[model samples]
Target chain A: MPDRSVAGPLTDPGPSHPCGGTSPRTGEPDGRPATAPGCNGRVTAPPDDCLARNEWICGAYLSSRRDILWGAVLQHLQLTAVSVLIGLVIAVPLALAARRWRWAAGPVLGVTTILYTVPSLAMFSLLLPVYGLSASLVVAGLVLYSLTLLVRNILAGLRAVPEETRQAARGMGYGPVRLLVAVELPLALPAAMAGLRIATVSAVSLVTIGAIVGYGGLGNLIYSGMNTYFKAQVLTASVLCVVIAVAADLLLLLAQRLLTPWTRRQS
Target chain B: MNILSEAWSWLTTSAHWYGQDGIWTRLAQHLVLTVVCLLISCLIALPVALVLGHLGKGGALAVNISNIGRAVPTFAVLVLLLLTPIGRFGEGPTVVALVLFAVPPLLTNAYVGMREVDQDVVRAARGMGMTGRQMLFQVEVPLALPLIMTGVRIAAVQLVATATIAALAGGGGLGRIITAGFNLASTAQVVAGAVLVAAFALIVEGLFELAQRLAPGRVRGGNTG
Candidate 1:
């Protein structure tokens, strides 16, 4: 509720007029002991030195920190993309194995479920000693978290291919791997896509937790903003994260539509 | 090897288990936060979802809107709340953030569960001279119990995991141990704290799984038509 109200007008830029007021100590360069005029008490002018480094208004902050922000966004995208991709690669084989060997499904799903349930913060800290605050630590945790969803969905998709279809494929002299790739994988696209959407968004979110170890995407901006009490920086970074998540989700939905036009027509 | 040995030593150190900052105290605090948030989220989300489900109108919109809550990071919400005036009160901001985070699954599952109940069964109950309330409670609810329980289980596990964020916002929880470890640069202590949180989540997951199994026979392990 508070987040909604706070973030609601993030893109409006109507507050830019108020932030233009000259900071009190701008002449002294330190900008110390000054209140930013006109802007709701949401922000205080950082020391002029800090202000020079980081812009004040939301728009200016975007432009001023564009390089850093873009880098963070790219990093964020990379983190989510790489983690989900890796998870998908691992999950497909595991799901296939589970399908072929029923006994393995239980233990495999159980292990992933446990990994998924581990709190992100705890998982990160648990690996700190072994990985020493590296991106690999975050990626490992994220990949594990994505496993439950990815594997379940892939299996569901593969299973959702009617038994008759599998039987028909076999009757056509298709071998196991060929049948899987040519027949099963195409049919399983929708479910797998759905899983991808969820995993990507979730990874985007979990990647922010990596900020604790100083590897977060927009999360770094959020942490800095909180520490410095810069409302613009915090709001901007948070908004961008939500934006990225929604965009990624929508793109996947479109891909699903393109891949499964039959489902769309039926719907 | 050194890390494991250090972790074991840190965990075994009895002094870490007592006092205000001890593992026991933080664990209790974490449990309390999680349970309280879960209860509050259920109270807020369940009735609305159930009633909407029973009515079979406007439920889709409610569920979709709540999905947006899932998209937003709980950590971002927590930080945003702490910036607002409500952050002044003890535990208020953390509770609000956690409750918001816990809502979407509970709301979605409860609604879907109710909707998934057999229509013929509802009609049968009504034919037997049952009041709407009676039909809802005696027929629909029992059928929907499994899914409703599933939602609760999900919310419970999620709350247990996310409650660790409370320490970041100055609220008490097991996360304090991790943060303290970070401050002290004691990797063993951090690992120990992480183990505690992860173990607690697994235990909660296990308890909920047991509860699901222990549901009434008619409602257990059977899909509603």
Candidate 2:
């Protein structure tokens, strides 16, 4: 509406786009008015782009979708981090309770196992009523799924701390709280970290299921790409998810080794 | 607008459960898809796992491969396969993606389970004039049944859950009900669909647990999926 008369170099649709864009909304361009004056304000697809070619591995798509892909990646990471952290926070106390009281273990483990068995789709759908299609729905579902893994491992680690070790700690003037914080928790790191690694990796994979909702991050890109059969976006986003999962697992494994150097191989 | 009551009514409606796209049809599709995928996965995974586990070779490689496989998101695989030429074959991609998914757990458990069987038992079987096949099926497999059942159970339950992806790719499943609800903006249908899928998965899991409980060799294998 401002000035269609002046077709500047920036507005050049190039030799490819005879009409501006395929989008019929003339004059008011769909996105980033790349229309030129020569074409009579009818913006069209790019003349020579991988996007137009619909190639599976399009560098142009990557460059153009850099922000979108990056945003999806970031959102994916944020969701994974937040849910796993929250899961950890909630799992520790539950693990402790399960370990402290014999009666609580069955109920805690039983409930979490049942939750884990719930399909991610069903889990999200079930939660949709409560969380209302938001990212929290994904996070809440993930946290609950993580509970089965985290609680079991954390409890196992705590249990694996030998009675002799506990007695020794107590003999050294360590109270129950101090023994737990200083000795028991550190000894429990190996198993707990293994659980964390698995939980984080699985969470990375599960976050893609969040695409069912609008907040799936890379999952959103993947979903829309799949709908449109956008080859490059789907491939790229899926590969990125894999890379993130492997990277997170490796990072956690490294952390586990560093934290529990005693568990390292003799070599 | 109580969601529970709405969902209850949605479920109670006779019309919703009596057509080609009815709840029954969808549930059957979901079950069939799940069973087919599980069968295919078992066929592909069990033999390889049993062989590798029996040989005590490639166990590490197999396990590592399965680890990588698990890292790959099932949804991405589903979409990727759907986008590829395989998508031309109806439900091919969904089946492939699900088989790929169901394999890792089955293979890992079977391989680990087979490898974990007591060596003394294997020696005793060999001493009793058992051939490799005989030792494998009779002694090794029997010893590993608990873990093998665990793997089968895990894979079965997972397939039941993930088969819902079939609906996304234009196939039939319980997921169609949910997606249709989304399209129609019917929260009740969505809830009803979700409840059905969740309940179905739980029932599958429970049945497996029951089978494992009743089965011999209560060797507490594969404690976690």
- Report the number of the highest-DockQ candidate: 1
Itemize residue pairs with steric clashes in candidate 2. Answer: A19-A42, A20-A42, A20-A43, A20-A44, A21-A42, A21-A43, A21-A44
List, residue by residue over B1-225, the lDDT tens digit for candidate 1: 798789889989999999988988998999999999999999998888888888898776767865587578777777777666677777788888889888888988889989989898888888999997898788888888888888899999889878886665466788888877876778898898899988999999999988778766665646444
Candidate that would win on lDDT = 2
lDDT of each: 0.79, 0.81
Chain A: TM-score in each model: 0.79, 0.84
Model 1 residue B65 CA deviation (Å) reads: 4.2
Candidate 1 local lDDT, A56-121, one digit each (tens): 344656666678789889988988888888999999999899888989989998888889889998
Off by over 4 Å in 1: A1-57, B221-225
Candidate DockQ values, in order, are: 0.47, 0.44
lDDT of 2 at B139: 84
The CAPRI class of candidate 2 is: acceptable
Q: What tens-digit string does per-residue lDDT give for candidate 2 at B1-225? A: 599899999999999998987999888888889999899999999999999999899877777776787688888888888777798788788788888889988999899899888898899999999999999998898788777878898899889877885565565689888878766778798899999999999999999888767654455453412
